[model samples]
Target: MIALCTPSVWAQIKNSEHPITGYAPVNGLKMYYEIHGAGKPLILLHGSHATAATTFGGILPELKKHYKVIAVEMQGHGHTADINRPISCSAMAEDVSAFIKFLKLEKVDILGYSMGSGVALNLAVRHPDQVGKMVLLSPVYKATGIQPAYWPMLPQITPEVFKGSPVKLAYDSVAPNPKNWPVLVDKLKTLYSQNFDWDQKKIGAIKSPVMVIVGDADMVKPEHAVELFRLFGGGQFGDLQGLPNSELAVLPSTGHVGLLFRTDWLLAMIQPFLNKQTN
Candidate 1:
């Protein structure tokens, strides 16, 4: 189930025709963003070392039909250049908060993949009023949520490791400084090295309803996803107590990157969940 994804397996942002594209000055960084469609705002956050277009391009068309999709490329990723500050979810979350304010948006729905999940979670916990709903795909609440086997590979990751890979190609295609791939990798390495554990109280205290999705064969432990669901008032006998505001999904036979390919399965769950009323 652990296999490398080819370039064809993922969609590129440049291939899609988006109506709005610009760079926003937020938190001392120029963040690249694209806005498509109309109606309620939906923010899309990509995984580590990924661009929003590469991460969500496959589903962007469908997402835009129903939402005012705002896909952003965070610092050191995509068209955004690297700054002297280190990369961390908390800091990125702050950048996003500033972005929302910059856009003059009141509340928006956020869908975050992999590393973006951490940023989404941080935003929900830190600025609950600004987030209406959240979708956390392949989330990690603590360092240990990552499988033990994958831990050994983190310290060894290099820009060269992604050579000739879709990840690298996507980065090379649109990054402001394509040669700075190594710099992005190094910053991400520092982010991964830092000890991170969101307090259980913070997870449980998040008021915004969330949808947690993961692949059964994901690098993140399935048990860890379950634990997060429990914190969201899940793991209950719904037949007796009614459904919780939050939701959980485990796509069968899916790997981490493979989870993005399951677009049909994702929309099937996401559309109804997002449309459902919280009140």
Candidate 2:
């Protein structure tokens, strides 16, 4: 049985406790993934500059009890080595799509955080039939979805800034080439610095049920989440018009880092949504 742990224990769990781990050859990169428990497939995608263990380690134990949790490390992050290509959310989403097809999973639930949430959104929009239910943590579809103040700092991000942080520590422990840390940072800097945004019409056309969760103080503005909710046909008077296929949740007084630790509250809300049938 996997015991619940904090992100600090990521290296320990990733090294010794992974139940099933393998590499999938997709999009010219050997993507690494870990599988735990048994039930309907639920894919877990980590944020940028993080590994699956760091992003979802706290809730993996609880989630594994109910679903076959498949945690994946995307391009240039964690165990997956970077290719000689630029990093983009759209391309990463396609890599995940190819990974799903590689596994022969017809449909699966997906939960993504931060950068991973953008990949999840791209997957849903690009391959709607392959996704069942989706949960986006601190998601942002457009460049403007993020707070304006954070923009000025994006291009200035460097590997040296996170020298002793958990993100850097986690990467050094598990990444194939720790020396490539600077390269990874550069790729991510370029990816986020772009003025890229998804088309609204495509977002509104997704058929899969969605759950949007955000911290009240998250980098992603609460108003942006509500706007995304409306695109999914939300913002209705639920008392009179019934609930929408999608949900929007704002955690009180939470920040991006602290949002993942509230596993108790997260599972309480997530279980029902994943189990509920959507029309």
Error of 1 at 236 (Å): 1.4
lDDT of 1 by residue, 88-138 (tens): 999999999999999999999999998899999999999999999899999
- Measured against the true structure, the TM-scores of the candidates, in listed sequence, are 0.94, 0.94
Best prediction by lDDT: 2
Candidate 2 Cα errors over 4 Å, as ranges: 1-8, 11-18
What is the per-residue lDDT of model 2 for residues 26-88, given as tens digits with 9 covering 90 to 100? Answer: 989999998888899999988888888778888887888899999999999989999999988
Global lDDT of each model?
A: 0.86, 0.87
Q: Mind sharing the TM-score for model 1?
A: 0.94
